[model samples]
Target: MPANKLAVVTGASTGIGLELARCCAEDGFDLVIAANEPAIEAAAAELRKIGGSVVAVQADLATTEGVDKLYAAVGDRPIDALLANAGVGLGNAFLGQDFGRVRRVVDTNITGTLYLIHRVGNEMLRRNSGRILITGSVAGFTPGSFQAVYNGTKAFLDSFSFALREELRDSGVTVTCLMPGATETEFFRRADMMDTKVGTDKKDDPHEVAKAGFDAMLRGDSDIVTGVKNKLQTTVANVTPNEVLAKQHRKMAEPGTAKP
Candidate 1:
Protein backbone atom coordinates (compact mmCIF):
# COMPACT_ATOMS: atom_id res chain seq x y z
CA MET A 1 0.00 0.00 0.00
CA PRO A 2 1.13 3.54 -0.75
CA ALA A 3 2.28 5.58 2.22
CA ASN A 4 -0.12 8.38 1.41
CA LYS A 5 -3.16 6.33 0.43
CA LEU A 6 -6.53 7.07 1.97
CA ALA A 7 -9.03 4.53 3.31
CA VAL A 8 -12.58 5.11 4.46
CA VAL A 9 -14.04 2.85 7.16
CA THR A 10 -17.64 3.10 8.31
CA GLY A 11 -19.13 1.83 11.61
CA ALA A 12 -15.84 2.89 13.10
CA SER A 13 -16.84 4.01 16.58
CA THR A 14 -16.29 0.63 18.16
CA GLY A 15 -15.81 -3.09 17.71
CA ILE A 16 -14.73 -4.54 14.34
CA GLY A 17 -14.87 -1.30 12.43
CA LEU A 18 -12.68 0.55 14.92
CA GLU A 19 -10.14 -2.25 14.79
CA LEU A 20 -10.19 -2.14 10.99
CA ALA A 21 -9.47 1.57 11.11
CA ARG A 22 -6.58 0.91 13.48
CA CYS A 23 -5.20 -1.57 10.99
CA CYS A 24 -5.40 1.02 8.25
CA ALA A 25 -3.66 3.66 10.34
CA GLU A 26 -0.90 1.25 11.24
CA ASP A 27 -0.43 0.50 7.56
CA GLY A 28 0.27 4.17 6.93
CA PHE A 29 -3.06 5.03 5.31
CA ASP A 30 -4.82 8.29 6.05
CA LEU A 31 -8.32 7.52 7.26
CA VAL A 32 -11.84 8.84 7.07
CA ILE A 33 -13.66 6.90 9.78
CA ALA A 34 -17.39 7.18 10.43
CA ALA A 35 -20.13 5.97 12.78
CA ASN A 36 -23.57 7.26 13.70
CA GLU A 37 -22.54 8.31 17.19
CA PRO A 38 -20.36 11.01 18.69
CA ALA A 39 -17.99 8.34 19.95
CA ILE A 40 -16.53 8.27 16.49
CA GLU A 41 -14.52 11.36 17.36
CA ALA A 42 -12.93 9.50 20.24
CA ALA A 43 -12.10 6.61 17.96
CA ALA A 44 -10.47 9.06 15.58
CA ALA A 45 -8.33 10.36 18.40
CA GLU A 46 -7.06 6.87 19.08
CA LEU A 47 -6.39 6.20 15.40
CA ARG A 48 -4.44 9.44 15.18
CA LYS A 49 -2.13 8.12 17.85
CA ILE A 50 -1.16 5.39 15.40
CA GLY A 51 0.55 8.10 13.36
CA GLY A 52 -1.67 8.86 10.37
CA SER A 53 -4.15 11.54 9.46
CA VAL A 54 -7.64 10.59 10.63
CA VAL A 55 -10.90 12.34 9.86
CA ALA A 56 -13.97 11.40 11.85
CA VAL A 57 -17.51 11.60 10.50
CA GLN A 58 -20.60 10.90 12.58
CA ALA A 59 -23.53 10.13 10.32
CA ASP A 60 -26.46 7.71 10.28
CA LEU A 61 -25.50 5.12 7.72
CA ALA A 62 -29.14 4.00 7.59
CA THR A 63 -30.06 6.82 5.24
CA THR A 64 -28.89 8.02 1.83
CA GLU A 65 -28.49 11.48 3.26
CA GLY A 66 -26.10 10.13 5.87
CA VAL A 67 -24.22 8.12 3.29
CA ASP A 68 -23.84 11.27 1.26
CA LYS A 69 -22.46 13.10 4.27
CA LEU A 70 -19.80 10.44 4.68
CA TYR A 71 -18.97 10.56 0.98
CA ALA A 72 -18.67 14.29 1.18
CA ALA A 73 -16.18 13.90 4.03
CA VAL A 74 -13.85 12.20 1.61
CA GLY A 75 -13.91 15.37 -0.50
CA ASP A 76 -11.95 15.00 -3.78
CA ARG A 77 -9.38 12.65 -2.30
CA PRO A 78 -9.01 9.30 -4.02
CA ILE A 79 -10.16 6.38 -1.91
CA ASP A 80 -7.58 3.63 -1.96
CA ALA A 81 -9.72 1.34 0.18
CA LEU A 82 -13.23 1.22 1.62
CA LEU A 83 -14.39 -0.88 4.56
CA ALA A 84 -18.19 -1.04 4.59
CA ASN A 85 -18.85 -2.35 8.08
CA ALA A 86 -21.87 -0.50 9.35
CA GLY A 87 -24.68 -2.87 10.38
CA VAL A 88 -27.44 -3.44 12.98
CA GLY A 89 -28.78 -6.59 14.58
CA LEU A 90 -32.20 -7.27 16.08
CA GLY A 91 -33.18 -10.24 18.21
CA ASN A 92 -36.40 -12.01 19.16
CA ALA A 93 -39.15 -13.45 16.93
CA PHE A 94 -39.35 -11.43 13.74
CA LEU A 95 -43.05 -10.64 14.05
CA GLY A 96 -42.65 -9.61 17.68
CA GLN A 97 -39.92 -7.05 17.02
CA ASP A 98 -40.77 -3.39 16.62
CA PHE A 99 -41.40 -2.38 13.02
CA GLY A 100 -39.21 0.69 13.35
CA ARG A 101 -36.25 -1.30 14.70
CA VAL A 102 -36.68 -3.84 11.93
CA ARG A 103 -36.63 -1.08 9.34
CA ARG A 104 -33.51 0.42 10.89
CA VAL A 105 -31.78 -2.92 10.64
CA VAL A 106 -32.76 -3.28 6.99
CA ASP A 107 -31.85 0.27 6.12
CA THR A 108 -28.48 0.21 7.85
CA ASN A 109 -27.42 -3.26 6.83
CA ILE A 110 -28.70 -3.25 3.28
CA THR A 111 -29.94 0.02 1.85
CA GLY A 112 -27.24 2.32 3.16
CA THR A 113 -24.54 -0.24 2.52
CA LEU A 114 -25.51 -0.70 -1.12
CA TYR A 115 -25.87 3.01 -1.70
CA LEU A 116 -22.39 3.77 -0.36
CA ILE A 117 -20.90 0.95 -2.38
CA HIS A 118 -22.62 2.14 -5.55
CA ARG A 119 -21.20 5.63 -5.18
CA VAL A 120 -17.71 4.80 -3.88
CA GLY A 121 -17.39 1.71 -6.08
CA ASN A 122 -18.04 3.73 -9.21
CA GLU A 123 -15.38 6.21 -8.28
CA MET A 124 -12.95 3.35 -7.69
CA LEU A 125 -13.85 1.97 -11.11
CA ARG A 126 -13.22 5.31 -12.77
CA ARG A 127 -9.89 5.53 -11.05
CA ASN A 128 -9.42 1.87 -11.89
CA SER A 129 -7.80 1.05 -8.57
CA GLY A 130 -9.12 0.35 -5.08
CA ARG A 131 -10.03 -2.37 -2.60
CA ILE A 132 -13.25 -3.00 -0.66
CA LEU A 133 -13.77 -5.06 2.47
CA ILE A 134 -17.38 -5.81 3.34
CA THR A 135 -18.31 -7.21 6.76
CA GLY A 136 -20.59 -10.12 6.02
CA SER A 137 -21.31 -12.91 8.52
CA VAL A 138 -21.45 -16.68 8.84
CA ALA A 139 -24.93 -16.07 10.24
CA GLY A 140 -26.04 -15.50 6.66
CA PHE A 141 -25.64 -19.16 5.80
CA THR A 142 -28.35 -20.37 8.19
CA PRO A 143 -31.90 -19.41 9.05
CA GLY A 144 -31.63 -16.88 11.88
CA SER A 145 -34.84 -17.84 13.67
CA PHE A 146 -35.00 -15.16 16.36
CA GLN A 147 -32.48 -13.05 14.49
CA ALA A 148 -34.43 -13.24 11.27
CA VAL A 149 -34.03 -9.71 10.02
CA TYR A 150 -30.36 -9.38 10.90
CA ASN A 151 -29.43 -12.66 9.31
CA GLY A 152 -31.52 -11.97 6.22
CA THR A 153 -29.66 -8.74 5.64
CA LYS A 154 -26.34 -10.53 6.04
CA ALA A 155 -27.47 -13.16 3.55
CA PHE A 156 -28.05 -10.42 1.04
CA LEU A 157 -24.64 -8.90 1.78
CA ASP A 158 -22.83 -12.21 1.44
CA SER A 159 -24.45 -12.81 -1.95
CA PHE A 160 -24.03 -9.24 -3.07
CA SER A 161 -20.33 -9.21 -2.28
CA PHE A 162 -19.66 -12.19 -4.51
CA ALA A 163 -21.71 -10.77 -7.36
CA LEU A 164 -19.98 -7.43 -7.07
CA ARG A 165 -16.61 -9.16 -7.02
CA GLU A 166 -17.39 -10.92 -10.27
CA GLU A 167 -18.61 -7.74 -11.92
CA LEU A 168 -15.37 -5.96 -11.03
CA ARG A 169 -13.10 -8.94 -11.63
CA ASP A 170 -11.46 -7.40 -14.64
CA SER A 171 -11.10 -4.01 -13.07
CA GLY A 172 -8.17 -2.88 -10.97
CA VAL A 173 -10.43 -2.81 -7.92
CA THR A 174 -10.96 -5.90 -5.78
CA VAL A 175 -13.69 -6.84 -3.30
CA THR A 176 -13.32 -9.06 -0.26
CA CYS A 177 -15.92 -10.16 2.25
CA LEU A 178 -15.11 -10.92 5.88
CA MET A 179 -17.58 -13.43 7.26
CA PRO A 180 -16.88 -13.57 10.96
CA GLY A 181 -18.96 -15.34 13.56
CA ALA A 182 -20.02 -13.50 16.70
CA THR A 183 -17.29 -11.44 18.28
CA GLU A 184 -16.76 -9.52 21.53
CA THR A 185 -18.67 -6.37 20.80
CA GLU A 186 -21.59 -4.27 21.94
CA PHE A 187 -23.73 -5.94 19.31
CA PHE A 188 -25.67 -8.30 21.58
CA ARG A 189 -26.66 -5.63 24.05
CA ARG A 190 -27.63 -3.22 21.32
CA ALA A 191 -29.71 -5.88 19.62
CA ASP A 192 -31.46 -6.86 22.85
CA MET A 193 -29.99 -10.34 22.49
CA MET A 194 -28.28 -10.66 25.89
CA ASP A 195 -30.67 -13.36 27.04
CA THR A 196 -29.92 -15.67 24.11
CA LYS A 197 -27.44 -18.50 24.01
CA VAL A 198 -25.41 -17.05 21.18
CA GLY A 199 -25.26 -13.72 22.92
CA THR A 200 -23.79 -15.31 26.06
CA ASP A 201 -21.51 -17.71 24.21
CA LYS A 202 -17.80 -17.28 23.77
CA LYS A 203 -16.93 -15.33 20.65
CA ASP A 204 -13.93 -14.51 18.50
CA ASP A 205 -11.70 -11.63 19.55
CA PRO A 206 -12.48 -8.39 17.73
CA HIS A 207 -8.81 -7.61 17.06
CA GLU A 208 -8.12 -11.00 15.58
CA VAL A 209 -11.20 -10.84 13.42
CA ALA A 210 -10.24 -7.39 12.23
CA LYS A 211 -6.71 -8.47 11.46
CA ALA A 212 -7.92 -11.41 9.44
CA GLY A 213 -10.26 -9.19 7.45
CA PHE A 214 -7.67 -6.48 6.91
CA ASP A 215 -5.15 -9.02 5.72
CA ALA A 216 -7.64 -10.58 3.33
CA MET A 217 -8.54 -7.19 1.93
CA LEU A 218 -4.88 -6.31 1.47
CA ARG A 219 -4.22 -9.63 -0.25
CA GLY A 220 -7.31 -9.18 -2.40
CA ASP A 221 -8.70 -12.52 -1.30
CA SER A 222 -12.32 -13.17 -2.22
CA ASP A 223 -13.54 -13.83 1.34
CA ILE A 224 -12.51 -15.07 4.77
CA VAL A 225 -14.18 -16.53 7.87
CA THR A 226 -12.18 -15.49 10.93
CA GLY A 227 -12.07 -18.55 13.11
CA VAL A 228 -11.87 -22.33 12.83
CA LYS A 229 -15.25 -22.82 14.46
CA ASN A 230 -16.86 -20.28 12.21
CA LYS A 231 -15.43 -22.00 9.13
CA LEU A 232 -16.83 -25.32 10.33
CA GLN A 233 -20.20 -23.72 10.99
CA THR A 234 -20.35 -22.30 7.50
CA THR A 235 -19.44 -25.65 5.96
CA VAL A 236 -22.12 -27.40 7.97
CA ALA A 237 -24.67 -24.75 7.15
CA ASN A 238 -24.10 -25.24 3.45
CA VAL A 239 -25.28 -28.86 3.62
CA THR A 240 -27.89 -28.60 6.34
CA PRO A 241 -31.56 -28.36 5.48
CA ASN A 242 -33.13 -24.96 6.07
CA GLU A 243 -35.65 -26.40 8.52
CA VAL A 244 -32.86 -27.92 10.58
CA LEU A 245 -30.87 -24.76 10.46
CA ALA A 246 -33.79 -22.73 11.70
CA LYS A 247 -34.31 -25.08 14.64
CA GLN A 248 -30.62 -24.96 15.50
CA HIS A 249 -30.59 -21.20 15.36
CA ARG A 250 -33.55 -21.05 17.69
CA LYS A 251 -31.57 -22.81 20.40
CA MET A 252 -28.95 -20.10 20.23
CA ALA A 253 -31.05 -17.03 19.51
CA GLU A 254 -34.39 -17.44 21.25
CA PRO A 255 -34.97 -14.93 24.03
CA GLY A 256 -34.63 -16.03 27.68
CA THR A 257 -32.33 -18.91 26.80
CA ALA A 258 -29.31 -17.53 28.61
CA LYS A 259 -28.19 -19.34 31.73
CA PRO A 260 -28.92 -17.77 35.09
Candidate 2:
Protein backbone atom coordinates (compact mmCIF):
# COMPACT_ATOMS: atom_id res chain seq x y z
CA MET A 1 0.00 0.00 0.00
CA PRO A 2 3.02 2.28 0.30
CA ALA A 3 3.70 4.67 -2.53
CA ASN A 4 6.91 3.05 -3.71
CA LYS A 5 6.71 -0.47 -2.32
CA LEU A 6 7.64 -3.21 -4.76
CA ALA A 7 5.15 -5.92 -5.74
CA VAL A 8 5.95 -8.99 -7.80
CA VAL A 9 3.21 -10.74 -9.76
CA THR A 10 3.42 -13.90 -11.83
CA GLY A 11 1.22 -15.13 -14.72
CA ALA A 12 0.66 -11.43 -15.27
CA SER A 13 0.08 -11.37 -18.98
CA THR A 14 -3.63 -12.06 -18.70
CA GLY A 15 -6.71 -12.79 -16.59
CA ILE A 16 -6.53 -12.42 -12.83
CA GLY A 17 -2.84 -11.65 -12.95
CA LEU A 18 -3.34 -8.80 -15.37
CA GLU A 19 -6.21 -7.40 -13.32
CA LEU A 20 -4.21 -7.65 -10.12
CA ALA A 21 -1.27 -5.90 -11.71
CA ARG A 22 -3.52 -3.14 -12.96
CA CYS A 23 -4.96 -2.67 -9.49
CA CYS A 24 -1.49 -2.63 -7.95
CA ALA A 25 -0.35 0.01 -10.38
CA GLU A 26 -3.44 2.09 -9.72
CA ASP A 27 -2.73 1.81 -6.02
CA GLY A 28 0.82 3.17 -6.55
CA PHE A 29 2.99 0.07 -6.07
CA ASP A 30 5.99 -0.44 -8.32
CA LEU A 31 5.64 -3.80 -10.05
CA VAL A 32 7.65 -6.70 -11.39
CA ILE A 33 5.26 -8.72 -13.55
CA ALA A 34 6.27 -12.01 -15.13
CA ALA A 35 4.62 -14.33 -17.64
CA ASN A 36 5.49 -16.36 -20.75
CA GLU A 37 4.51 -13.78 -23.30
CA PRO A 38 5.56 -10.51 -24.92
CA ALA A 39 2.20 -9.20 -23.80
CA ILE A 40 3.84 -8.55 -20.45
CA GLU A 41 5.65 -5.61 -21.99
CA ALA A 42 2.36 -4.23 -23.22
CA ALA A 43 0.77 -4.69 -19.83
CA ALA A 44 3.64 -2.87 -18.15
CA ALA A 45 3.27 0.04 -20.56
CA GLU A 46 -0.42 0.40 -19.80
CA LEU A 47 0.14 0.12 -16.04
CA ARG A 48 2.80 2.85 -16.17
CA LYS A 49 0.21 5.33 -17.45
CA ILE A 50 -1.05 5.38 -13.87
CA GLY A 51 2.44 6.65 -12.84
CA GLY A 52 3.71 3.46 -11.14
CA SER A 53 7.11 2.02 -11.98
CA VAL A 54 6.89 -1.34 -13.76
CA VAL A 55 9.26 -4.04 -14.98
CA ALA A 56 8.23 -6.93 -17.19
CA VAL A 57 9.79 -10.38 -16.94
CA GLN A 58 8.89 -12.98 -19.54
CA ALA A 59 9.52 -16.48 -18.27
CA ASP A 60 7.86 -19.87 -18.39
CA LEU A 61 7.28 -20.65 -14.72
CA ALA A 62 6.89 -24.37 -15.37
CA THR A 63 10.66 -24.80 -15.15
CA THR A 64 13.06 -24.18 -12.25
CA GLU A 65 15.36 -22.20 -14.51
CA GLY A 66 12.52 -19.93 -15.48
CA VAL A 67 11.60 -19.41 -11.87
CA ASP A 68 15.21 -18.56 -11.08
CA LYS A 69 15.34 -16.11 -13.93
CA LEU A 70 12.37 -14.23 -12.45
CA TYR A 71 13.81 -14.10 -8.95
CA ALA A 72 17.16 -13.01 -10.25
CA ALA A 73 15.50 -10.03 -11.90
CA VAL A 74 14.44 -8.81 -8.47
CA GLY A 75 18.06 -8.69 -7.17
CA ASP A 76 18.17 -7.80 -3.45
CA ARG A 77 15.18 -5.46 -3.38
CA PRO A 78 12.62 -6.30 -0.74
CA ILE A 79 9.29 -7.10 -2.32
CA ASP A 80 6.47 -5.56 -0.27
CA ALA A 81 4.14 -8.15 -1.75
CA LEU A 82 4.31 -11.27 -3.89
CA LEU A 83 1.56 -12.93 -5.90
CA ALA A 84 2.26 -16.49 -6.97
CA ASN A 85 -0.39 -16.70 -9.66
CA ALA A 86 1.41 -18.55 -12.41
CA GLY A 87 -0.39 -21.79 -13.28
CA VAL A 88 -2.05 -23.76 -16.10
CA GLY A 89 -5.13 -25.97 -16.13
CA LEU A 90 -5.99 -28.80 -18.53
CA GLY A 91 -9.50 -30.20 -18.77
CA ASN A 92 -10.74 -33.48 -20.25
CA ALA A 93 -10.80 -37.07 -18.98
CA PHE A 94 -7.32 -37.91 -17.68
CA LEU A 95 -6.70 -41.06 -19.73
CA GLY A 96 -7.66 -39.36 -22.98
CA GLN A 97 -5.46 -36.34 -22.39
CA ASP A 98 -1.88 -36.02 -23.52
CA PHE A 99 0.60 -37.09 -20.85
CA GLY A 100 3.05 -34.31 -21.71
CA ARG A 101 0.35 -31.64 -21.32
CA VAL A 102 -0.67 -33.05 -17.97
CA ARG A 103 2.92 -32.96 -16.80
CA ARG A 104 3.25 -29.35 -17.89
CA VAL A 105 0.11 -28.46 -15.97
CA VAL A 106 1.50 -30.13 -12.85
CA ASP A 107 4.88 -28.56 -13.35
CA THR A 108 3.41 -25.06 -13.59
CA ASN A 109 0.51 -25.21 -11.14
CA ILE A 110 2.35 -27.17 -8.44
CA THR A 111 6.12 -27.15 -8.86
CA GLY A 112 6.52 -23.57 -10.04
CA THR A 113 4.13 -22.17 -7.45
CA LEU A 114 5.75 -24.09 -4.60
CA TYR A 115 9.27 -23.20 -5.65
CA LEU A 116 8.48 -19.50 -5.96
CA ILE A 117 6.61 -19.49 -2.68
CA HIS A 118 9.47 -21.30 -0.93
CA ARG A 119 12.06 -18.85 -2.19
CA VAL A 120 10.01 -15.66 -1.95
CA GLY A 121 8.44 -16.70 1.33
CA ASN A 122 11.89 -17.20 2.80
CA GLU A 123 12.80 -13.70 1.81
CA MET A 124 9.57 -12.32 3.25
CA LEU A 125 10.26 -14.22 6.48
CA ARG A 126 13.74 -12.78 6.70
CA ARG A 127 12.32 -9.29 6.24
CA ASN A 128 9.42 -10.04 8.58
CA SER A 129 7.34 -7.52 6.70
CA GLY A 130 5.53 -8.47 3.53
CA ARG A 131 2.47 -10.17 2.11
CA ILE A 132 1.93 -13.23 -0.12
CA LEU A 133 -1.18 -13.89 -2.18
CA ILE A 134 -1.67 -17.29 -3.76
CA THR A 135 -4.25 -18.07 -6.44
CA GLY A 136 -6.07 -21.18 -5.32
CA SER A 137 -9.38 -22.44 -6.75
CA VAL A 138 -12.78 -23.82 -5.76
CA ALA A 139 -11.90 -26.73 -8.00
CA GLY A 140 -9.63 -27.93 -5.21
CA PHE A 141 -12.51 -28.64 -2.83
CA THR A 142 -14.04 -31.41 -4.97
CA PRO A 143 -12.80 -34.11 -7.30
CA GLY A 144 -12.52 -32.77 -10.86
CA SER A 145 -13.05 -36.00 -12.76
CA PHE A 146 -11.98 -34.68 -16.15
CA GLN A 147 -9.51 -32.08 -14.97
CA ALA A 148 -7.77 -34.56 -12.70
CA VAL A 149 -4.30 -33.06 -12.83
CA TYR A 150 -5.48 -29.46 -12.80
CA ASN A 151 -7.77 -30.02 -9.86
CA GLY A 152 -5.10 -31.99 -8.03
CA THR A 153 -2.71 -29.10 -8.47
CA LYS A 154 -5.24 -26.65 -6.98
CA ALA A 155 -5.89 -29.06 -4.11
CA PHE A 156 -2.21 -28.84 -3.32
CA LEU A 157 -2.31 -25.04 -3.59
CA ASP A 158 -5.35 -24.67 -1.31
CA SER A 159 -3.76 -26.84 1.37
CA PHE A 160 -0.27 -25.48 0.96
CA SER A 161 -1.45 -21.89 1.31
CA PHE A 162 -3.19 -22.63 4.61
CA ALA A 163 -0.36 -24.67 6.13
CA LEU A 164 2.15 -22.03 5.14
CA ARG A 165 -0.10 -19.31 6.52
CA GLU A 166 -0.24 -21.16 9.85
CA GLU A 167 3.52 -21.62 9.90
CA LEU A 168 4.03 -17.91 9.29
CA ARG A 169 1.35 -16.74 11.67
CA ASP A 170 3.73 -15.40 14.28
CA SER A 171 5.99 -13.83 11.71
CA GLY A 172 5.25 -10.26 10.68
CA VAL A 173 4.61 -11.40 7.11
CA THR A 174 1.18 -12.56 5.92
CA VAL A 175 0.00 -15.22 3.46
CA THR A 176 -3.46 -15.21 1.91
CA CYS A 177 -5.08 -17.64 -0.49
CA LEU A 178 -7.57 -16.34 -3.05
CA MET A 179 -10.05 -19.04 -3.99
CA PRO A 180 -12.24 -18.05 -6.92
CA GLY A 181 -14.91 -20.05 -8.68
CA ALA A 182 -15.41 -19.73 -12.43
CA THR A 183 -14.17 -16.37 -13.74
CA GLU A 184 -14.36 -14.82 -17.18
CA THR A 185 -10.82 -15.48 -18.29
CA GLU A 186 -8.89 -17.08 -21.07
CA PHE A 187 -8.11 -19.92 -18.70
CA PHE A 188 -10.95 -22.19 -19.77
CA ARG A 189 -10.47 -21.54 -23.45
CA ARG A 190 -6.75 -22.13 -23.21
CA ALA A 191 -7.40 -25.31 -21.24
CA ASP A 192 -9.81 -26.49 -23.95
CA MET A 193 -12.91 -26.44 -21.80
CA MET A 194 -15.16 -24.16 -23.88
CA ASP A 195 -17.77 -26.86 -24.25
CA THR A 196 -17.98 -27.60 -20.56
CA LYS A 197 -20.77 -26.14 -18.44
CA VAL A 198 -18.38 -24.54 -15.98
CA GLY A 199 -16.55 -22.89 -18.85
CA THR A 200 -19.51 -21.82 -20.95
CA ASP A 201 -21.67 -20.46 -18.16
CA LYS A 202 -21.45 -16.77 -17.26
CA LYS A 203 -18.55 -16.22 -14.88
CA ASP A 204 -17.57 -13.70 -12.25
CA ASP A 205 -15.64 -10.75 -13.61
CA PRO A 206 -11.85 -10.99 -13.39
CA HIS A 207 -11.62 -7.46 -11.97
CA GLU A 208 -13.96 -8.38 -9.11
CA VAL A 209 -11.96 -11.48 -8.26
CA ALA A 210 -8.70 -9.53 -8.38
CA LYS A 211 -10.08 -6.84 -6.10
CA ALA A 212 -11.17 -9.44 -3.54
CA GLY A 213 -7.70 -10.99 -3.55
CA PHE A 214 -5.89 -7.64 -3.32
CA ASP A 215 -8.08 -6.41 -0.49
CA ALA A 216 -7.88 -9.68 1.43
CA MET A 217 -4.12 -9.82 1.14
CA LEU A 218 -3.83 -6.24 2.34
CA ARG A 219 -6.04 -7.12 5.29
CA GLY A 220 -3.80 -10.13 5.99
CA ASP A 221 -6.69 -12.56 5.86
CA SER A 222 -5.68 -16.22 5.57
CA ASP A 223 -8.10 -17.07 2.76
CA ILE A 224 -11.03 -15.63 0.80
CA VAL A 225 -13.67 -16.97 -1.56
CA THR A 226 -14.48 -14.34 -4.24
CA GLY A 227 -18.21 -14.55 -4.86
CA VAL A 228 -21.53 -15.31 -3.19
CA LYS A 229 -22.10 -18.41 -5.30
CA ASN A 230 -18.56 -19.57 -4.64
CA LYS A 231 -19.12 -19.16 -0.90
CA LEU A 232 -22.33 -21.20 -1.13
CA GLN A 233 -20.64 -23.89 -3.18
CA THR A 234 -17.84 -24.06 -0.64
CA THR A 235 -20.43 -24.54 2.09
CA VAL A 236 -22.23 -27.26 0.18
CA ALA A 237 -18.99 -29.04 -0.59
CA ASN A 238 -18.16 -29.12 3.10
CA VAL A 239 -21.50 -30.80 3.97
CA THR A 240 -21.86 -33.13 0.99
CA PRO A 241 -20.48 -36.66 0.84
CA ASN A 242 -17.30 -37.01 -1.21
CA GLU A 243 -18.99 -39.61 -3.41
CA VAL A 244 -21.81 -37.21 -4.25
CA LEU A 245 -19.50 -34.31 -4.88
CA ALA A 246 -17.28 -36.40 -7.09
CA LYS A 247 -20.26 -37.59 -9.10
CA GLN A 248 -21.50 -34.04 -9.57
CA HIS A 249 -18.06 -32.84 -10.60
CA ARG A 250 -17.75 -35.67 -13.07
CA LYS A 251 -20.97 -34.69 -14.76
CA MET A 252 -19.70 -31.14 -15.12
CA ALA A 253 -16.18 -31.93 -16.31
CA GLU A 254 -15.71 -35.48 -17.54
CA PRO A 255 -15.60 -36.11 -21.27
CA GLY A 256 -18.50 -38.22 -22.60
CA THR A 257 -20.46 -37.74 -19.36
CA ALA A 258 -24.08 -36.63 -19.87
CA LYS A 259 -24.90 -33.03 -19.07
CA PRO A 260 -26.89 -32.51 -15.91
- TM-score, per-candidate, Cα-based: 0.99, 0.96
lDDT by residue for model 1 (162-213), tens: 9999999999999999999999999999999999999999888999999999
lDDT of 2: 0.90
Candidate 1 regions exceeding 4 Å error are 1-3
Estimate every model's Cα lDDT from 0 to 1: 0.96, 0.90
lDDT of 2 by residue, 22-65 (tens): 87888888999999989999988888888778999999999999
The alpha-carbon lDDT assigned to residue 108 of candidate 1 equals 100
Q: Which ten residues in a row have the lowest lDDT in candidate 2?
A: 251-260
Could you tell me which 10 consecutive residues in candidate 1 have the lowest summed lDDT? 1-10
Q: What is the RMSD, in Å, between candidate 1 and the native fold over all Cα? A: 1.2
Cα misplacement distance, residue 80 of candidate 2 (Å): 0.8
Off by over 4 Å in 2: 1-3, 256-260
